[model samples]
Target chain A: MSWVNWILVICMYPFVLIMYFCLKNEGHDPKKRVYYGVSLSKEQAEDQIVTEIGNAYKKQMKRLLWISFLTSVPVLILPSFSIAFTYWCFWFLFVCFVFFWPFGIANKKLREVKLEKGWTTGEAQPRYTEIKEAAGIRKVKWYHFLGPVVISIACVVWAVLQPRDGREAMLIILAATFGGMTLMFAALAFWMDKEKTAIVSSDSNVNVNYARARKNMWKNFWVAFAWFNTLYTVGILFYQVQESEVTGMFWLLLGLYILFTVILLVWVIQKSKALEERYADKMDLKVEEGDDAHWLWGMLYCNPKDKHTMVNKRVGLGTTINLATPVGKGVAVFLILTLLSMPVLGIWLILDDFTPIQLKVEENCLVAKHVTEKYRVPFEDVREAQLLTKLPNIGRNYGTSMDNVKKGNYRLRDESISCEVLLNPENGLFIRLETEDEIYLFSGFDDTETRQVYEAMIK
Target chain B: MVIILQDGSEVPVFKQIRNQIVMGISDGRLQPGEKLPTVRALAEEIGINSMTVNKAYQLLKQEGYIMTDRRNGVRVRESFRMTPELPLESKEQLKQLVSEARVRGVSQEEFMALVEEYFSAGQRE
Candidate 1:
């Protein structure tokens, strides 16, 4: 497990590097960043303002790249799972220092440059017609949603038919993720339709260029997300955990997912950057208008009057919540709560593996209790009871189990019956009972205690 | 082909849509029998209500600027010809315009030249 953590860290460093580059490269587009769509006048262009700005940006990027590389080296020394708390704190602080602080500084520098060069425009004069036409085209067609819809439906059918108890939780989570993404994509498409493009270009060609670029970026994003979700669902559906490779394949799949997501994000960022560079000249022109006050801390949008809860980032390919609005605040709170709950859930899962399971005899019935699930059997329903020293080598056909804690339905090898099993594998003291309808199997983690219970049951 | 709606304008939204389409037609930007976007599509494109676009389409249909059918949807009329006789409303409007020009002390020649300039501007667009 520690090695797994270390491997993850090592693998993620490149992703962090790419993210750093993207942030450092922010505001490289003077059209969108400085003039806010109003291109610089010919005089402004020849003033060497653009050149000075470029030099300043390049210097900052170079310095930040070095710092990023140096800071990331600490991961090599941090062992997986050891000092987990400290490691996580360091990770959090490192991210903020590298990304957040640098972003703010760079944004401020760009603003200063804009002021110095008199590049900031008075009003945004975007070609509204071209923008409207582009927005109309950017909508997600009916067919774009087909993949996720079909996948979710198939997941439901698979869950009902297969009924793998242990994997049921995993399957349901996958289904919800895909289904939720479908809804999100639809919502985002509509939101984008109403987005006020802030570029102030009179050049219809430049407006079209920007619009088409945005459209392509969104299209690629949705397509990639849909494909990734479908592939993950398919993987989970057909995945069989072999006895020889306990948890190995599962971990492998998780690692692959992380790498795939990182690659997708990098590709999107690089593509967006390329498009900006390619269209920068065409979009650069006389300054007209912009909304410099809409952003807070160079990242968060703080528009009190804006009705939008989520908006596209000025410099990137993601949506940021406008923290100024009530709805946005609610969304922010929800996100924070979700983030905080993850570690708590992890702790709960870890504790579940250690909790003792209690099985006791009652006046007229038997009771079994684990941490969460409980079971009971009336004496009247018991047809036969037997204690065995050895049990068959059974696999968890469908249900959850740790090293010793096992519960739920299972298939016994070389047997036709699908028995209801609730047992800890450590006990090796098997309690088999035959009811009128079927057989039930139970085991205990402690062999001595389990044997005594079995004897008492027989008596 | 661009419809710019002024929020504080005296004209309503539907009228704006109707006027733009009519202007587009007269300027030859919209060819004879050219297909227009469906009412729903136009409404969504402009971020306006469907009823507004519907009103505009209905007006265009009534004025003979556009025609609609079950299969073809909305389109510019196949042939456009100026009416030989001006409607009473249009005549009244012309009279008011002439009276305003007279009051402004503009010569008939100057007024005719201004009209020619305005009409040619539309053609150029």
Candidate 2:
């Protein structure tokens, strides 16, 4: 047997074991039960049933994430292995990873908490009751894996049986596989959209409004698609340059892809901007006197404002907590780091270096250091606070950041002071109270304000 | 005006709706004859099952807090007033308990004496 077959067999072993474990652990596990509003001894049987269900969910998620990740590994390594092997593994991995990542993480987190706290604990109670009810069982749909498995098997067989020694056959097979996958994805997305509409009655005005928002979002998907295409076109250009054997046909396709991408991106941006402006105007019109409308557009855009506000009230807390902005800043930093690291490590193999970093704010201190990054700051020495504000400038030099700054359009407003006090533990920090205007800077952080605004957040 | 659902609360959705409407009435939020959203419309707006809203409306109607007419939709009951009275069954039960107390060598005067003593004790702090 060839090395390809050996590798395939090794990969298949884990897949079979994972599937079996998931299937065996399909129902609730008694060990993970939660006893609430009753004596443990009296509710032991019911608790057992609940625990079993929770454990099954945990196992199912573990299986899904592991299988998805394993599948993705080969696919991600495909481009590098393409010359040595007939199939592309990277694309397969990419699709599986994206499809399962969110569900996997949510399930894993739930399971971890359940195991740590045990079944009888209130905190370990299954929080996904609604989701489970909606999804029915915590098992993968047979149809989900059917298309990919068939394609994978067909590729393996074709690679082994095909008589051609040239790369053309391999290229054709890869293209065909990708094309088929794309068609399947499009069909799936269409079906999901249809299902959403079906679940909510069409006559309901709220449903109608939600549907309109969804439609608007669907239109916005083109923005993401355009960006992807633009990036893909750039990758193809790089490939053509590196491998100088490209024909006229490749150039034609590349040119078409770039044109379509640019046009769609411009259209998406213009439409999105128009929609946003209109939305803001509508919201402004709806505001009434004495209404406790604490939400602004930015808050609504980033988080589900209604849900968060209700959650805050339920916890007997005010909606004054602004953890969203800090979380958003960390996410922005992550994205920047990932984008920066792309060239150094080939995008496909970048996951090997993936590590999570946490930045925490304590009662008296704030820390903005990553787990992987070399820089570390412990709030103690951070004595200075500055606010860098910028204004938009139109006309002569529209595109340059330097020109915009040089035009004195950017000025630091020193009228009101705001500052953050950092603490040791880094989960809860303090802000010195100054004035209403100064507190506006901390509005995004959690509607709270300080006497001196930090320079780090000004931009 | 819209009432938002409290997802994290232990309070049932129907109870939340009922309480909000009651508060609205007491605070003059809903005028005497102002038509409220139909059960279906309210349910849709709140993103909850229509049955939940219907249940709240049914409770409100039974309590004389709101009145629903086929032609006019639902509205705050005109000339509604809250009255404090013990239920017939509860009053009967209380009488039985007092009779039992009398059987145990406790007279009406003695019971009154105990009540006064308990009240005075409660007020002392």
Q: Top model by lDDT, which number? A: 1
Q: Determine the C-alpha RMSD for candidate 2 after optimal superposition of all C-alphas.
A: 30.2
Model 1's DockQ score:
0.10
Per-residue CA lDDT of model 2 for A1-459, tens digit only, reads 234423433443444443334223322222222121111232443445545644655565666556654654453354333221222233223332332333334334444443454633433121111110121111223353444445444444544464432333433454344434434444433333322221122122333343355444543453345234334433443342232333334435534554554455445445544543444323311111111122221121123222221111100001122224554445456655765453344432232222222233444443332222222233444443333232211111111111001110111223312222211111123322233222211111211222132433322
Worst 10 residues of 2 chain A by lDDT: A396-405
Against the native complex, each candidate's DockQ, computed on alpha carbons, is: 0.10, 0.01
Residue A14 lDDT (model 1) = 73
Candidate 2 docking band: incorrect
Once superposed on the true structure, which residue ranges of model 2 sit more than 4 Å away at CA? A1-169, A176-259, A276-281, A285-341, A344-459, B6-14, B18-125
TM-score of candidate 1 on Cα atoms, chains taken together: 0.64
lDDT of 1 at B20: 74
Q: Rate the local accuracy (lDDT) of all candidates.
A: 0.64, 0.39
